[model samples]
Target: MAELSGRFRELQDVTSSPTSGVPLSLTQREPEPHANNPPLYDGDPNSCRAFLSQCLLVFALQPRRYATERLKVAYVITLLTGKGREWGSAVWDAGASFCTDFEEFRAEMTKLFDRSVKGDEAASKLARLRQGGRSVTEYAILFKTLAASCDWNEGALRAMFREGLNFDIQDESRLRLRLRRLAPHSSWRLEETLPSKSHPPPQSPLAEPEPMQLGRIRLSAQEKQQRLVQGLCLYCGGSGHFALSCPLKAKAH
Candidate 1:
């Protein structure tokens, strides 16, 4: 019992020693300090308020430019959200920027949707409104909303219809009918013309002098005999006698 206690004490002492077993130096190496400063993660309401205020200021100071840019930015954000790093980077490289306010951005997005839902039927409605001298911007805004709210293809057809309807009424009807026919196969927008399926016909070569072969054939013996033949010639397969004695009836007869 005495010897066993001594062995146990020796084992405990070895484990507790700084210089023994598993090399204390290996475990005691000092940790390297971080290169960056500690992150300042302020969970306070004040910090959030300040950040939001700055964004609002930026938005308000340049609403028009920001509005235009924000439209594109919002589209990018929606595309990138929930995607992996590779997809996010792809979108970023593809010219997508971040928008500070999604709500304002969405309001603009609604305009596009509204236009699409109207499909190709909005042209006459828009024309009537236009002839009545309604505010063009208001009319445009209504169209925009319609465009933003619907499927991309549908919106495009609606826009094309509106554009076609803007021309002369008679021409507009033909254009509208064409658009209606085209709507199923394509999503053509009002802001642009539809692409043609085939190129224009090539121009013909310049005129040339008649060929010698054709000219000679025109004055050949056969040709002269054909000219001499009268009505119902037999040799030339008509009902007259021979080409030499073909008769001519008097005009009075």
Candidate 2:
């Protein structure tokens, strides 16, 4: 970490203005299409890929902002929390060389935390996955995780997903299959499987609408990104705190 820090300082020195002594990167305006802040990571092996992917997305979208390997790695470290933060702190204290290189940092983190199978291995596990006693949502999350590493097409994936579902869900999905079978000779029509408004499907009691402040307009994707980067409350665009601790958001609840 000392070596990495020294390298970063050397780069900063080279980039510093002769008159102002401020680094050129710091003087430049932030890039557009600001990336959303990734959720804090807790060193869960199952979620490491997702966390890393979010970090990469942020870096990719604002290449100029994260032009240096040190900057990219530093951004990732800021998002670490709980066990993840502990691991990052240890690496920093140990003076690990990989801590400053984005690719090396990613490789090291993946080796330590990425446990998901890929390719044929992932496919095989997905094939054997069962809904069992878990909710459909839970099963689907697991299914999608494994499917991400597989090379299967949509239709094949759909079929595999259906096969792993619980009997009840399978029975429910069969209604769509039945409709398809009835129009085997006709072109596929999605509307055929949908219930009419006159016979609306039952709504789940747990699907209540979230509480919202009156006259509060939805933020656009760009606005959300800006608020997040500014360290402002995402709910009301107030400064000094983030969304989780926003009093306005708490009051709405």
Candidate 3:
């Protein structure tokens, strides 16, 4: 601890002095623009990983700017606020040895602030998730987000996905299964035959209703023969037209 404190003091003195005879690499660095700075973290456990990940990305993109571990750690310190700022400020003021190592700093921050059990949390949420009124696309997107962290096998994922779907979608899936079992690329059109509970087909206004039929009295064979001989209609026994062009038959249709 004493050696680390002395090293920290030496670094501080070397940075503060203009001609301390320190190596060029140990000298103070010029200020850079903060346009690419990561979002400020306020010690929210949920956002800790995301904030650190952004900082890492910035460091990766501009390696020359953050060449030293201290520079990387200092840059992250500047972005902290709230409880995070207090922690960073205390570490910086005390000149902690870990502050000179970015990897150690990151690991410490993760251990301190990251409280989430990602796989367990994801699995719990996925177990309770339901499609409800949402579309299949929307449901699938949400399901996939949780499924990524669950580490479940493909069959388990499929079962969970199907279980979360709306009742209507489940019914359609069952119909699809039946169709597949009947034939590959079956000709049966379930969608056309079965109407949706949400939206039923509308009746056409232009369609005509069937006309009522009138019962005819029984006629003897001689009467029927006489009607046929007289070019009369056999259906109604009308003389104006034959059975093929009968007005009563057309009217009955």
Candidate 4:
């Protein structure tokens, strides 16, 4: 009996933490994630819609065990500005009742924003997406983001992207980009499919010669050499048939 009691005491001591005098299960637990600060967002239709997306992303990215939809919406409202600033106040009424679902609050904000929000506007923006000064990758991102709200299939989206591409990109490049996206089975890349400019075009046999003046004749290399040696200057020393017409001479005044 005495030995059993001593062994049980030793087991208890081994399982407990010596520094804090607490069991591992009770002591080793992490808190739910909560943002100390959220990104500032105005109530504009364009920027606010993007802000809502970011707010949702923050919750997804953070490590949390018991975070609620209500908490997420509350955090999002805290960062609102302009007309958005008043929304935080109006969220709670006299009885302190407020929206509990994140989706409901997001929808409410969408309706509340003054300008045209993400619907037809989003589709229109995607249709008109152009590279302009932006890179192909950048244009792809903008188009894809706007396209999320639209119902375009892969082929139609590819066609739209090609139509809005910068004029500097050759038709071949636009075709390559479109083909790669349209054909799911084949493997192709923009970087790998670029045209090589290293080789010069072959000279055409039927190409026209440049027009020359009637009185002046273009000289052959052999004819010019023969004429160059024939000229001897008693005055100024120079070369070529130009030397024959030299008006320059040494004059003692």
Candidate 5:
């Protein structure tokens, strides 16, 4: 420590001397942007919000840097002019005015994507939602996703989600009862509420009703003549006998 202090004082003494004509070396540098960073907002889909949100995950950034609007804009310019640049081309063809900053750009992109959800619109969409052919898991996913776009609280959201399901789904056993018992504003769980399409609900079609029995009727003379001509006995099943002289049927009298 003493040796280092002596050396520092000696260097200061040398620098303090007016005759020492060596100019002090400046060692400051401007931070350069990363050259290899991938372009954002390619616009295959409405991914601007996702991209921006992901920028906040600073764990992988060198020295954990924050993404500023100006920096984002610089990257945005690159994505506007390459192969698979439909989003950028659309922007240009429409002759939309350039954004003044990152927030304006994001807003315009969000509006373009129809991602800006109004309360009424979102509520109406959520209100009209139905389980349809999808399973409970799929329906839940869609419900939660649509609900995210709206400002409704969990309790009202759950009620609306339940109400929107198909009548069959609502009338389903234990599921309805359990969902009803949940506390307001709480999560509701399903234990196999919706059946898979592969295993549909048991279907028992209306069977043919029982037929009423009727008493046997006596044959008419025209029918008897027809039977006689046809060589069939009237009362008994023998072929040769007629009704009047039928011996097998005579035993009954």
Candidate 6:
């Protein structure tokens, strides 16, 4: 009887061991079917299609959640869709769109475009215009005119204009000429009357003799004393006698 018990215990251990008996691999089981009803999407073609369509709709309506480096793509997408108007309104209501850096602008742009265009042609055009020497206002005008000619919606053009105004081209000469035209009368005259040459003519140091020492003359006691003591004429600080006895003075006399 003891030998039989030992054999039975060995058989029990073998059945419990994973590698021994029928090995039970752990697997996630499918949820059991409800007894009373079925799932809303279970094996129904129409429901499955509807569910997928709704998911796509949500993605389409939602703003893209990733960062993008392409500014033109954002601009074009906003222009094509009505999202640009929404963005402009929000920014206007907030009272400003000029942020601290390009990153903030880009973030705002991405938020404005609900979806991203992988290789948008409109974006390429914007990039080219930016690189070309067109002012933002000029580009916006051209864009609006061209879009209108091509039968694009008017509302989109207006939104694009609002967004484009933030980018201005630097024209130094145009700015200077504009400022000159707008200046006050006095400022204008001052600018206009300024001498062409900054420096005056070079002067000759010894071209003519001074008036007080031009001719020989006798000096008074006071003048001679002043000249001897100070080495300068009493009338002029010249290296001679007083102005009263100067040759120029004698000529006048």
lDDT of 1 by residue, 44-144 (tens): 32233333334445446534323444333332332322222234245344543333345554343333222232433433333223313433334445644
Q: For all candidates, what are the clash counts? A: 26, 2, 0, 0, 0, 1
TM-score of each predicted structure versus truth: 0.18, 0.52, 0.49, 0.49, 0.41, 0.15
Model 2 spans with C-alpha error above 4 angstroms? 1-31, 132-141, 152-158, 166-253
Q: Say which prediction, candidate 2 or candidate 3, comes out ahead on lDDT.
A: 2
lDDT at 109, model 5: 61
lDDT of 6 by residue, 159-188 (tens): 223323322324534533443453344212
Better of 4 and 5 by lDDT: 4
| TM-score between candidate 3 and the true structure | 0.49
Candidate 5, residues 31-111, lDDT tens digits: the string is 424634445555534455555454433213422132344334333444443322456445544545553356676676655
lDDT of 3 by residue, 1-253 (tens): 2443454455455545555565555324654345476778989997798799899888777665666788778778878888998898789879889998999999989998876447766676776677788765566667666766766654445444544555444466565454344335424322222334564323323334322222333444455434544555556766765444456656655
Over 41-65, each residue of candidate 4 has an lDDT whose tens digit, in order, gives 7677667666777777777765342
Candidate 3 local lDDT, residue 207: 39
Per-residue accuracy of model 2 over 1-253 as CA lDDT, tens digit each: 3454565456555543244664546435544486898999989988899899999998788765567887677667767888888888788668689977999999999999887688767766775777799865567668777877877654445545554555444444555565455446633332142343454333323433323233455555455434444545545677875444456655544
Index of the highest-lDDT prediction: 2
State which candidate, 2 or 3, has the greater TM-score: 2
How much does candidate 1 score in TM-score?
0.18
Query: Which scores better on lDDT, 3 or 5?
Result: 3
Ranking by lDDT: 2, 3, 4, 5, 6, 1
Q: Which candidate number would show the highest TM-score if scored against the true structure?
A: 2
Off by over 4 Å in 4: 1-38, 62-66, 93-96, 114-120, 170-253
Tell me the lDDT of candidate 5: 0.48
Once all C-alphas are superposed, what RMSD does model 5 give against the true structure?
27.5
Off by over 4 Å in 1: 1-132, 135-138, 152-156, 159-189, 193-253
Per-model lDDT: 0.35, 0.64, 0.62, 0.51, 0.48, 0.35
